[model samples]
Target chain A: MMKQSNLLAIVTCALGLAALSPSAMAEQLLEQQCASCHALQAEDYASSTVQERAERKAPPLYYAGNKFRPEWLVQWLQKPERIRPAGYFPAAHTVPGPDGDVVDSDSLPEHISLSAADAELASAALMKLTPYTDKLDAVDYEVGNISWRMGNLNFGKFNGCDACHRDAPDYGGLSGPELYSAWDRLQPKFIASFITDPVAWDPHTLMPANDLNQAAVQKLSDYLKVNGEDE
Target chain B: MRYALVTLAVSALTAVSAHSWAADAEAGKQLYQIYCTQCHGINGDGKGINIPDMSVLPRDHTDTSEMSARSDEELIKAIKHGGKAVNKSVLMPAWDKNLSDEQVDDLVAYLRHICCDK
Candidate 1:
């Protein structure tokens, strides 16, 4: 009876050991693959010089927990796609042509991919990396609606956000990331607040702090969500 | 009489070219309203919606004193290539990948009409 009980205890311990926690796997994967290219600890690229930040291989993932949805992060890790067609500050990174024009020659390398299980682990791990948890928690997020025609007009005409950002692939500006999937990939609260005062989020970010009231910012967020739905 | 006829012919030819040039500028004006007016301002005054928030103010396109100093070649290159191509601000993204050569030239013409024309 004593031997059987000991054997059962050992089996339970072994099973627990074999099940490597998602946090452990995440830390390992992040250190092994992501940390090599990404500044996982900091979002101070905004403070760095233009030339300094432009050389980065990837955007900082320190704020990923606050910026991205867990589902989107998991799917993206499994099947990575190009987000920023132009690198961060494309002007500083790409070599210019003899005609003194910048061609879209330089772009970011392909994002790293992970297996389904690994992606899930990484996603869980990343979702827990919330340095801004207190601040983010304070935000009051609500699903809302905005006028479709007015939203389009604001993006292209009033705000000129489309000048640098794309609504979808093959449309809008080439500089910023595509916003068609923004609703899925990003938190709406982050989007509206970031644009309201960009410097509040990223001091050296090239995106001009747009002169938009609170209502406009919310409407813009709603527009992005609606636009993503259509696609 | 032959000299008078030659003068008339030259004037007509010049008028035809000028008319074509006007159409190009007109097309450029439409493009500007669509793409640039928001940043450069409706009257090309560089006081768009983002003006208050910008640290470095956008170039006032209507500033004849500055625009007159730059040649057409320089202006066209800046428009098509971006600011960093000419060692200017990196805030200006290149447009050549999206715009054709003719469209760039037209934008340059429109800039001239707005900023440099007496």
Candidate 2:
């Protein structure tokens, strides 16, 4: 009877060990390194004031699990790259040239990279962050194959998005983040939410709320997907 | 002497109010650097960095012929209410919420001065 009791105690103790779980370990490491920059437990997507956001050392990754593809996240974690060329705010970053373009490209702090193993662990932990999962359940969308011609027409001629973004690296305008790789970079649901109501995510964002429905936002996402795949 | 002093004070008070009401192109230029240059370009030429990203181009402020045709009231309306108010693009966000009435007029003054050399 004592032997059986001892065995049961050992089993219970083993299960109680928090470090035994990969997720727990990931959480530990995230607290160690990433907590300084990323809002690890950020339920609030809108971080704070304009000055606070402008001086932010890094972008929030609270929705990384839903915002980015695992493959991209893992790769990106290993090899950090600058995504927002013009920083976060149009007010803070934009500087006029003698002509009709931005003369001054604001300096952005480099993203601290992680080792392959650390990246894997961090990616796994980040993947578990699904703050929008419940909200996304209500946002039903059907991603279609948007044609390039039609997509270009809609983006450039109709919606006028091409004014701030481009379909290709060398083609589009500056100011907003580049869009050619948006489909791959951003999660489908995030793209939909942002386009549907920009103020919902970032109130200070220069992007005007166009009042697009779910369908229109999906179509735009689809167009980005098509364009993103080409080059 | 007291009459002269009163006259001077009245004139000085009127001047101060008039100065406050008059648009400050310098202040407008600073605001433009912070807000408008991202989409409207530095020189008001409508060819800002996000030009390719936009479906419709921003109005070129350097286009004297085109801008000259527009009255100060029309420009002020567009600045305060956004392009959609003037049946233009929706991309231009309403500055009514962001800028003060005086600031909007200053921007109008700046635009007028820059585009038309008025």
Candidate 3:
């Protein structure tokens, strides 16, 4: 009877340990694979200098939980694609052309793809890394459909986001990431929070904090959410 | 006595020019990169990355004839109050919140340097 109880206790402890291992293993995998290029810790990149910005291999993943949707992250990890066509730093990858500085697509490298199982683990771990708990909590998304005309006017004309970001394929600016997949890739709250105050998220980020009111922020968020849905 | 007066006038003029040169154009170049390059091109030739999408092209700072036509006050107003303030394209955003009066002056000086200094 004593032996049986001891065995049962050991089995229970083993099962608990097994349950915790997935997350622990995922973290270990990230440290080994991602830490070399991607910043896992919330280390601020002093990207004030052009050289420092150029040195960045990948976008910092410490804010992944705050930024990316879990489903998107999982899928993207398994089938990685170039979000920034010119790579992280456009200057390094661009060549002087007749028109202006044109991005050299040949210079860009393919992002590393992960296995299905690894992507699941990695994404799960990434989703748990919410350092900006307060910022995330404060996101009040005013959910609704924004008309194309109104959205375009606001994003392009008023806010000048089209100055850096693309709203559709081969359209808009090349300085920032293509926003066509913003709704699918990012959380609505994250999008709103980011637009409301870009400097709060990253001090040296190239994005300007337009000091927009809550209504304006919500409208912009909605615009981004529905940007490429029709296309 | 006349020679002394001429020398004093020249010295005063030199001081003013020197101050303007030192404080404005150089500072403006740095600020332009931070705030304007996305839509104003790295070379300030008006062919920014966003040019393809924009209905109205950003003004070429390197256009000597066009830039020389506009007064410093007009340029300052446009920079501070956006294009709509000057009856220009509304695409140009107002930099009133982002830039100070002094900074706008510096940007105008830099615009002059790029457009007219050739």
- By lDDT, the best candidate is 3
Docking class of 1: incorrect
The root-mean-square deviation over C-alpha atoms between each candidate and the true structure, in angstroms, is 16.1, 7.8, 7.5
lDDT of 3 by residue, B1-118 (tens): 9999999999999999999787888888877866676667778888765677777889988999999899998998888877777888866766765566987888888999999998
Model 2 misplaced stretches (Cα beyond 4 Å): A1-25, A28-49, A90-100, A103-106, B1-35, B42-47, B52-57, B60-118
Q: Can you write out model 1's per-residue Cα lDDT over B59-98, one digit (the tens) per residue? A: 7788999998888888887777776567665445456644
Give per-residue lDDT, candidate 3, residue A123: 94
DockQ of each: 0.02, 0.31, 0.23
What's the true lDDT of residue A5 in model 2? 87
Candidate 2 or 1, higher DockQ: 2
Tens-digit lDDT track of model 1 for A1-231: 579989999999999867867677678888887887777786555365333444566776777788898999989999998777555544433333332223254444667799998898888877777776655565555668767787777666556567667886766655567788998998877786676666555544555553456777777888898888877
Candidate with better DockQ, 2 vs 3: 2
List runs of model 1 lying over 4 Å from the truth.
A1-20, A43-51, A92-107, A138-141, B1-65, B68-118
lDDT by candidate, in order shown = 0.69, 0.72, 0.80
Task: In model 2, state the lDDT of residue A148.
Answer: 90
- Write the residue-wise lDDT of candidate 2 on A1-231 in tens digits: 579989999989887884367777788889988988766765343454333444455566777777788878788888976566666555455555554566356454567889998899998998888877765565676667888988877776667676666577776656667888787777777777677666555444556555556667777877888888876
Ranking by DockQ: 2, 3, 1
CAPRI quality band, candidate 2: acceptable
Q: For candidate 3, give the lDDT of residue B40.
A: 76
True-vs-predicted CA distance for residue B89, candidate 3, Å? 3.2
DockQ category of candidate 3: incorrect
